[model samples]
Target chain A: MKHLTTKDLMTAGIFSALYFLAIGLVTFICMFTLPVLGNFLLPAVAALTTGSIYFLLLKQVPKFGAITIFSLVMGTFLLLSGHFPLAIIANLGFSGLADWFTYRTTFQTKHKSLLGYILFSYGLTGPLLPLWFMKQQYIDNLTSRGKTATYISGMFQYVTPTFFILLMFFILIGAILGGIYGQKLVAKHFGQTSSKQISDLYD
Target chain B: MINIQIKCLLLFITHIFLFIPFHPVQQTVLVGLLLSILFLEKERKRSLLYGSIYLVLLGILIALPYFKSFLGHSFGQLAMVFLLLYPCFLAGSLLIRTSLLSDWILLLKKCRLPMYLILPITVMFRFIPHFKEDFKHTFRLQKMRVPHSSLFKRLERTLIVLLHAAIQSSQELTMAALAKGINQLETRPVSKLTSLTFLDYLVATSSLGLIVWRSFL
Candidate 1:
């Protein structure tokens, strides 16, 4: 296994910091400038930024530590901030999964394709944890107000379908954008470096 | 510096608290107080401008209804709306004030998360300002060309520029990462450096305490 240098750690740290800043900026914009739309797009923005940075960082550092560090910090912030605790955990878990799927395999072949990066990076949104938490809260609100079980069930029946469809739409959008970005990056700078080329450098 | 972790906690608690059935007058006052705090603490001039605009719009929304029904229960509903809006503004201000982006990555490292997850998010975070800057630059360029376009045309053009910028920047950003050798799995000894500070603990405790007190105490 290749060992990461101090440079790699610093790179990851910088990337992670940038990631948080982007989310904060968008969240603020959405909250103040576009409340209704902001509610929908904030998560989408978060996902897009996360995917982009992850791909970028992974291509540069190719180390688990950087990715790990980024996710842990983000997850902890989410947990402490009292945002959707379950969703934050899921986000962190998915980050690890996405990294493992893309990088671990690429290491063997020594060729990190844009497709693999997009697929893995974009897959992190599959949990849609935030939406799930929001839906659950809505349900809780309805049920606690003395609504009948039937009413709550009916509400979910109507809401869940729409929510799932939206989630799928956002996920696809994130994947396509992530792919485009990854491909452009590969073509632009690392055209000669394949997973195989990387192996040679390390070997 | 305001720790990102504490800011996040404050935002979280604020959102949850807003849902409670507070009286409309109290809610409006709370919203005012929150907005005032944000206006005072926010650093970015542009964000402050946008926030003030939003607050004004919200004020108009609340007042318009009141003017029509000067003494009816609409005042109460308006107050409720204000209450709901208050936290969102506070959240926005907090986002601008705290250095969440870098700190978040550090915090993630301590937790032993994987690279795949971190990479995408990091990229996305970088994209925001780039998007903003690009959008503004393009908008200015377009305005020079069509200085008198109708509002609709101007808005349409702005959207187009934003989309194009997002696509282009994402590509550039990804390539930059690749050039830096970001996509491989290397083992680095996880730093023993703790991301948490005393402020983080204080914020967490206070936020949780506030929520508990509000909900049941």
Candidate 2:
């Protein structure tokens, strides 16, 4: 339990894939189905759906570096799949912070883990940051890809400061809701409500 | 068939190419070139599917104004991004569909990543297909039990079962890998027994050539 065992890494990988699929499904559906609300709904929906998977991973591994490894794989996948490279940086920052936060509680308390999930959920905003922060590059990219000026303008129509603030708010609400649901799911299904239960099963 | 390294190289090049401000015609050519490579590799079905999707999206973009009143411009914007990302999507599909765990392990080992990182990544890739199947099975089972349930309820139950199955299988998979001495200190480095074929060489050269050409454009 001190270091990441091969088994721990393997479990992390398996769950990372699951987590990615959950997030990917939500994002893809939102992006295509509700073009207008897609950007705003994506992070919130992703955070909402992925909480159970994330909680399960924590319950299984419950060690340092588990969250880090999970997020690293996700960030790398996003980058390879054409997300802005800053996605990786944001992922590392948030996941590291989440890992540290969980470690501070020694993975014992539920409150700290919920806080960690809230922080980790902010990482979802990384991919969309380029829309606001690097507006020119984003425009140039669309224009280069042969988008019409109308299309580009339409894309930016929702990228206002208000929307950005709203996006963060959605992320926070989603994280809180998802974290509570996730805790309930873990406590019900795994029967391990406390760190002592997790340690006894794994360590 | 192309090796994992070549597939990864193409994927990497495609990612970079996505951001490059190439002329519209040149960008289309690059996508066609990559599709041709997929065709060469005998993935004609997927290549054609991707090719048709690209054309359909392009058609939609061209006819943007007609749909604008109802669908709004966001539809066109999404179509544009998808159109541009078509080739990248194709390259990624090829990589994911074709690669094996041994190939990834060999490649990651060549890059000298630690065992922990390598093991997880490999397992992730390996588990994806299995998880998909498990998800389908669980969804069907949940639907049978609660035939009148709401979609959200069915999905939630399915996911719960899916996660439980995944955690259970992870324990089994770890034991299987460990029994095979995956974590042994004295294990030999994975050797490449298959040499690069002529097609592999041609694909590599043409992919690199496309990247270089796109960069200058």
Candidate 3:
């Protein structure tokens, strides 16, 4: 319900651009690395961490404009970085949903609990669901190609499970880190300075 | 003056041509011709320079996959990279040149999309460029202050500034939208909206025709 000042609007714009640049950089790095770990790590962990940092800063800045900024930058970055068009669309859609959810959770609850909002934001990573599905399809395609048993067995043993596990790990890690950062931000900005507040940061 | 209809149709034809699986040489030639037509309209010298620069960049971009193969990469890997990157770049360029954000918004409105959804999208489009500029300015300021930070630190600082900005702006944007009478519940008749021109029809028809031809012929 709070109106953003001119300064706040300016800040939102800046963050959005940074968000785009960061995503592009991370994705570019992953492309060069082309490692299974790099693929999941860069897109999931890097992106979510950046989002969390945005939320943490937003607590003090108190601007909803950041949501739009994040969405635009991420969408543009994905588009320009040669990701699938659907991925770009998903990024925008999910970011918007995450923004709305964060806003509702913070304002409606009247507590501005960072943990709640962080969890809400993390849930919006549902866009990555398609990646997992795609991986399964790739495995199936390989199997259908009559690839050697050793290759199939090696992929099933190493590639498939490693990807899913890494993805899940990064998602959870990103969420937990974001939640912690959010709590720290709330405590610092909202002046809930207590030992309990510090301890409750992860909650 | 080029008829807007013709221009729109040309745009559609170009898009369709770009997507077809033409031979590599044919694709390059088509791309060159299209780029020339698109960029070399008014100032011959400037367009020539632009076209040359574009070709150089595009050559590098396209050759990157093959370059990797030359450096001991497999054909399949190189082909995969090309497949993933080329369409995305083409699609992005097309979207930037041909698609208007406002037009998309109008279409959404016509489809009776909820304001909550439409408003955020509109605001985001409006905000992204502004945010990018602001972040650059902030980064400059931060650089002036630190002047010697590591690259990682500099990046962190930049991100921090951006996050701060986003939190500060949304409320003002939302209020500005509300002030413009955007949130009103009154519904207007969709039939009263502006009609599509002949160009729109021509472009639509040609695009569909090209798509069918490319897909089935």
Best by lDDT: 2
User: For model 2, how does the per-residue alpha-carbon lDDT over A91-186 read when each residue is reduced to its tens digit?
Assistant: 989998999998866655899999999989988888667667867765776677677897667666856899789889999999999999998988
What is the C-alpha lDDT profile of model 1 across B84-118, one tens digit per residue? 44555456456544555556555445446566545
Worst 10 residues of 2 chain B by lDDT: B65-74
Recovered fraction of real interface contacts per model: 0.01, 0.53, 0.17
Tens digit of per-residue lDDT, candidate 3, span B1-217: 1233333344445434433443333334434543454353334564455456556555554443344322222223333333323433443343344445555456447557554444545555566677668767977888899999986677666765665455546445545655665544235333333566664465456445545655553
Q: What is the TM-score of candidate 3? A: 0.58
lDDT for model 3 comes to: 0.49
Predicted structure 2: lDDT:
0.77
Query: Which candidate, 2 or 3, would have the higher DockQ against the true structure?
Result: 2
lDDT of 3 at A166: 68
Order of candidates by TM-score, top first? 2, 3, 1
Candidate 1: residue B87 lDDT (0-100): 58
DockQ comparison, 1 vs 3, better candidate: 3
Q: Rate the local accuracy (lDDT) of all candidates.
A: 0.51, 0.77, 0.49
How far out, in Å, is residue A74 in model 3? 6.5
DockQ of each: 0.06, 0.49, 0.17
B-chain TM-score, candidate 3:
0.62
Best by TM-score: 2
